[model samples]
Target chain A: MASKLGIIAGGGEFPGLVIAACRADGRPFHVLGLTGHADPKIIGDAPADWIRLGEAGTGFKLLKEAGVAEIVMIGPVRRPTLKELAPDWRTTKFFARVGLKALGDDGLLRAVAKEIESEGFTVVGIDSVLADCLAVAGPYGGLVPDDQAQSDILRAWEVAKGIGALDVGQAVVVQQGIVLGVEAVEGTDSLIRRCAELKREGPGGVLVKVRKPGQDRRLDLPTIGLATLREAAAAGLRGIVVQAGGALVLGREAIGAEADRLGLFVLGREDAC
Target chain B: MASKLGIIAGGGEFPGLVIAACRADGRPFHVLGLTGHADPKIIGDAPADWIRLGEAGTGFKLLKEAGVAEIVMIGPVRRPTLKELAPDWRTTKFFARVGLKALGDDGLLRAVAKEIESEGFTVVGIDSVLADCLAVAGPYGGLVPDDQAQSDILRAWEVAKGIGALDVGQAVVVQQGIVLGVEAVEGTDSLIRRCAELKREGPGGVLVKVRKPGQDRRLDLPTIGLATLREAAAAGLRGIVVQAGGALVLGREAIGAEADRLGLFVLGREDAC
Candidate 1:
């Protein structure tokens, strides 16, 4: 008997990518879409169910009934507001136990993961299932960053670490050592857009994204994709740097080709410090 | 001869406020407008000179010639780009000595301050001249921050510290635990405006402005004014917090009156950590 893999899908193309991977390998799966966030088309005709974002117990019961033992949660989900979600009694009870520690997003995710584990489903990082999607740890594309960009990348690397230490964000945009934008709850795409507006014509501009120090990688890893490359080029950025082996760069070949077309850089910086 | 106080003024109302203070007390002064940043009209009849931003030599020469030994640098100056300023021989030579550290605004300011001190000029904090302009510590409104707003403030305080630790910026806007805006090159008013758009109807939005830790007090101090109060009210925020004794709240009476009228809180949280 085949053990079915379960997928908890959110927004963005990640769920689509994961589904493609699952199907290519002939893995049977159950998809649970978080209502209002997940794309219906991505779930397709797969054995699937829909659950409101805060309906923990309902989601758990459905997955259990479907005979799923392991799951991968993927894609972007804006942190839902309690009022907006109107959490059911089960989620409310779960949060009550979480209490004040659930104030931070990381804490809330950890607590949620722990709850699901206690109920007997294992939470595995989606990356383990799709290691090929991990960002390449070197210069990507035809364009190599110039000396000025290297300097900017180092400065941004230091600044990003400071940002990550607080767990407020994962990315900082810099040009000639001036920070154009810092990501927060608004997310990275918005951060890149804001940087495009704030940027002055300059010699050195780079996007630096890093994993939060002490962050649990199994839950969330800093990620970039084709959209990030397009936006960086639009923002007149010279390069993009991610902590090597710590971020996902989906469709890496396409992203590299795009970067080359735009005369931009996609570098997975191991250590600029 | 009364020791003449020199004002190195930038944009915004802070310079105007300081000018009024000097005039009210009959304090002899010389004002130097950083070209393109300061409003020429703001100096109105005050003995003032205009110098290109980053023309440090010209600025120092003028102040020395005017027999000014003490100076206060005030208001917001868009950190000048090298090509835009076309630095004079002195600033060019200075940057050469400072090397790559000249890359950041804080490093540049610190370097400039050291140079000024080396030339025998004492840089004084503007608050020393007008204590009333310093933000009042504690409550100042018709409405107090409820529990949720308080939680947001603490979260924002932590985030702002991280931003400041990198010498990036000094303000952050938050709602619940979500950071709506982080101030960087765009400045505070722009940050507030951005937040107004990002805000969803909520119980917890607040502005937390703080002095960067280990930042030089003689230079930029975190500031807010009646404009901030009106904008925050427009954004549907519940409260505001600035580190006690560390921020400027221009026209205190008017700010308090406006906050009361808008039913918003202007709290000066000393240390809620």
Candidate 2:
């Protein structure tokens, strides 16, 4: 029998989808829901334990005690300050060991995964479990981007790459040759919502998301889902583009349907930065 | 006698400050206020004529008829779509002649200045008109940045330069090694205000503004005024840092006094990116 899967769930519908995937495949799994992040409804009936971010000791112990053999950390978690983190003894020791090496999002995540591996647990990525969720190349939902949107997409791609190389952000919004906004720690949803208020009167902006340069593919690849689609539509955005095979597309069918209904294009481009 | 100055005013108090400088120095001037931007109070009772942004032909004619010789363009103007700009015949011809070369802010500004220069007018920098407004090196208001704040300032400087080189923006906000936000077409005030909402729970961020790489210094040098100070204070930012001698600091004495009163450090750093 395959080893039981351990899911370290964070915010958004992503965690719930992963749990549903496990059930559908008859794969036994356990969840470690991060407090203040994972939805209560999603963790409701699952065999799970809840812990604060600083409670790394409790988290790892719970997973081991629950007979979890393989682990996958999923979803978005707001970056907390050192004070807010309030790291426990084990967590403090972990940071002390890593030192400044764990600075950017990818660095910190890789360090944590290494620690988990050192604790005798195997680590996996969400893509391995839900291969269909990886965005494919081409227009999604049978809608193609217009020439104007294509131009904006290309501009935003260059910007996203620039910021990503600096480890500043992974997404940008551009409209009619003007950059509407750039994502930072505020995340993509907030980025889109704010850019909506700053949109120009002409064609709406396009949101382009790509993976950060030198990023660890296993952790925190760019993601778009139903919630992101709704935000973009409400923000009067013309379209959404994610790096093909470099980002995740959650609830793909539903997202495509919503995009078509809203007269917006959802594309996964391979020619991306 | 000095040539009558042609003040092409946009939004913000910078324009009003220029008019005041001209008045104090006994230099005759005519103001051509862009309708939607210039404050009504500032343009009131001055030798001024108001016109929409697209009326370039009318604006130039008014300046020429006013016996103006030198021109200075000051203040922030939101980037408008071509439709919103509603370019007149001359403006259309100007864009056509410049073509793709006038895409970025600096590029567009240079093209416009060249056009004005060709029309028997000399273009001058705001520093030429208001020399004291240039930011100087050193800690302003007697407040010094703590080590942590200094680190964030340095980080934001690099990000600012990264975006600037791309001709994307000139300002960025950073806290605890995380980039809070980056300015784009929405401008710095909005960038600071929005980042305030996304500020981390611990130390507030620092706003860093620098000259864009290869920017035309005579046009749109990064600027901070009393309005910017209040916005930063309201946003709970620890300090504001601009490239020393590379940016404009309007109302310098008042800004120092306000920064002192608010217990925020306003420094002009020479070791900038």
* Model 2 lDDT, full chain set: 0.87
Candidate 2 off by > 4 Å: A100-105, B100-105
Clashes of 2: 0
TM-score of chain B of each: 0.95, 0.96
Q: Least accurate stretch of 10 residues (summed lDDT) in model 1 chain B?
A: B99-108
* Backbone clashes in model 1, listed as residue pairs: none
Error of 1 at B97 (Å): 1.9
Give the range where candidate 2 chain A is weakest over 10 consecutive residues by summed lDDT: A98-107
lDDT per residue as tens, model 1, A1-273: 335778898888888888888788887788989988898987777678999987988999999998888888888777766676678888888988887436545677778778888999988887867878766678777777887788778878887888778767889998887888888778888888888888876575799999887766776788888888888888788888988777888877888898889888898878544
Give the lowest summed-lDDT range of ten residues in model 2 chain B.
B99-108
TM-score versus the correct structure, for each prediction: 0.96, 0.96
Whole-model Cα lDDT of every candidate shown, in order: 0.82, 0.87
| lDDT of model 1, residue A151 | 74
TM-score for candidate 1: 0.96
